[model samples]
Target: MQKTNNLGSIKRLQREYAAFLKSPPPDMTIYLIESSVYECHFSFKGPSETDFAEGIYHGKFIFPYDYPKNPPEVYFFTPNGRFAINTKICLSITSFHPETWTPVWSISSMLEAIRAFMLTPAAGAVGGLESHSDVKKEFAKKSQYYTCPVCGANHQELKKIFLLENDKKNLTENIEHQLKINTSSTEVTSKLSNYDKTEYKLENVEKDHKIIIEKENNNNQQQDIIKEENDIITQNEINNECKEELLTKIENDEINKETKEKEEEINQEDDVLTILKKRQEAEKEKIKHFLENKEEIKEETERNEKYTVINETINIIFYLSIFLIILMVLNLLKIKIIMYFLN
Candidate 1:
């Protein structure tokens, strides 16, 4: 079973590679690496009108044995500012996000996705860089002459060869398509000529003459009917003009009345808005006054607390002084009593 799957993968890869060579994607070319079907080298020119423009970048793709059942590893060997050199970049189409891979996706689609991703921000994705635009532009200038070490081919030279081959293929296709169209038209013309060679008899000629006479009479009757219709249309047009004038006058009157009503409503709305503004201002002033009064009350309470604390501290100090003098007086009395007893 595994061998069968491997064969299937190789076959699929061979088909895709052949198709890519037959009609390569715009601005890109792929080459098999070391003659291995599972590994390929690709190079593409930068998208026009971008920082990466004027640059050609080279990259490598390594396909797993499971092939389309799994995604390919994508790495850029070129020193493009958007991705690290020789590092596998994280992208939905890359091996980093295999869940998004599908068998329907081809090498062309992968190249398109990579090209589009180059123009986006790095956003901290693995192997992505946020290089300055100036730096990227410098790299773009140098990239034109860059040769891939692995591929051993100049980027611009490869691009030229691819463009030449693609142009030849497209021109051939156009020529073949035109030839097909011409052949079909020639066949149709030959068929029509053969159809026109049918024999006609005298009875057919007589029937054709009768048809012409009947057609001429019908045309004369239609002309007369058309003249009558024109007369009726002119009369209806005159009626419509009068009706239109009356409608215009009525519409003008209604429009003037509507304008007057709209103006009155606008004036009423302006007056209401002014009143609301005045009320808002009054409310704001009230709030401001209340806040000021609250602040003043807070300050007064703070001041009172401070004064009470200072008064308490002073009273305690005065009591301590009086108690110390009483102690001194008692000591002096005791000394005098001793002297008297000794005498």
Candidate 2:
């Protein structure tokens, strides 16, 4: 049963991969590992006008054997300042939240969602970092030259290739369109020239047309060479800029390190003060409880004393009534005796 499930998962992934090739996601490229359909590599540019802008991020997705029923683990190998490098991030669409996973959700949609999520605050999220805007911006700039260990290509090279491929496609389409226009023009010219026929003149005209075509081709080739040279110059400039930035960054990091140590010391002092305040509050609470208990005890003792006094007063009154009754009985007995003697 397990084997069967694995096979099904592979099939599903293959189908998805085919569809992906047919209509790839915009501004991103996904490459499935040659050995396994379960693992995939993806690269994309960071969203523009955001903290992550101008960055090319490389990441991986590891789909589970029971995929579609479970979400894949998402990991970013790039240091984008939003997520930790090579760590599986916790997101609603990731393996951490299987309940939210749906069979309909494809890799493209997940990438889109992740790009959007990148703009959100970290807020102490797992596998997320709360970097300063300046630090993030610096990272974004550095990302262009960053090389992906898995892909074995730097961001700049990857982007250049992507652009080249698009340019080639556009160039092909333009050339085809131009050829059709030239073919129609050739037919029209032939029809017009036929009205003023001369075989020798026609041959000369054809030769002139071939020369023009050759010149155009040479011009195109020269333009291509110039573009390549410009690209090389630009790359050299970028490298120099990166070196300077690295030097400045190193100096800034040293300053930041010192500031961090001072901040940590201040935080430690604040922590101690907080601990002392908590202890004092606890002592106050204990004292308040003791005083409350003492007051209750005092009130209870007074109530007991009042009850004892009332009981004593009732006992004294009862004894006095008994004595009066005894005296009255004795007098009545004496009167009865005297009357008997007189009789």
**Predicted model with the maximum TM-score:** 2
Q: Which stretches of candidate 2 lie over 4 Å from their true place?
A: 1-5, 162-343
lDDT of 2 by residue, 1-343 (tens): 5432265676677667656655666667776554455788888888978988778888899999888778999998878889998788999899888888888999888899999989988888789888899988888888888776664646888677556655656666766776776677677667765545465346658865875786588559657955874785687457545534543454456457668979999999999999999999999999999998998999999999999999999999999999999999999999999999999
Instruction: Output the lDDT of residue 271, model 1.
Output: 100
> Local distance difference test, per candidate?
0.77, 0.77
Models 1 onward score TM values of 0.47, 0.48
- Model 1 C-alpha lDDT per residue in residues 1-343, reported as the tens digit of each score: 3432255676677678667755667788776654455688888888889999878888889998798999999998878899998888999888899888888999989999899999988999999999989999999888888787765758766565555545556555755675676566456556654445333333346755765575576556556545754664585467455534543454455456668879999999999999999999999999999998998999999999999999999999999999999999999999999999999
Cα lDDT over the full model 1: 0.77
Model 1 lDDT, residue 94, Cα: 86
* Per-candidate clash tally: 0, 0
Which TM-score value belongs to model 2? Answer: 0.48
Residue 79, model 1: lDDT of: 82
Which candidate's lDDT is highest? 2
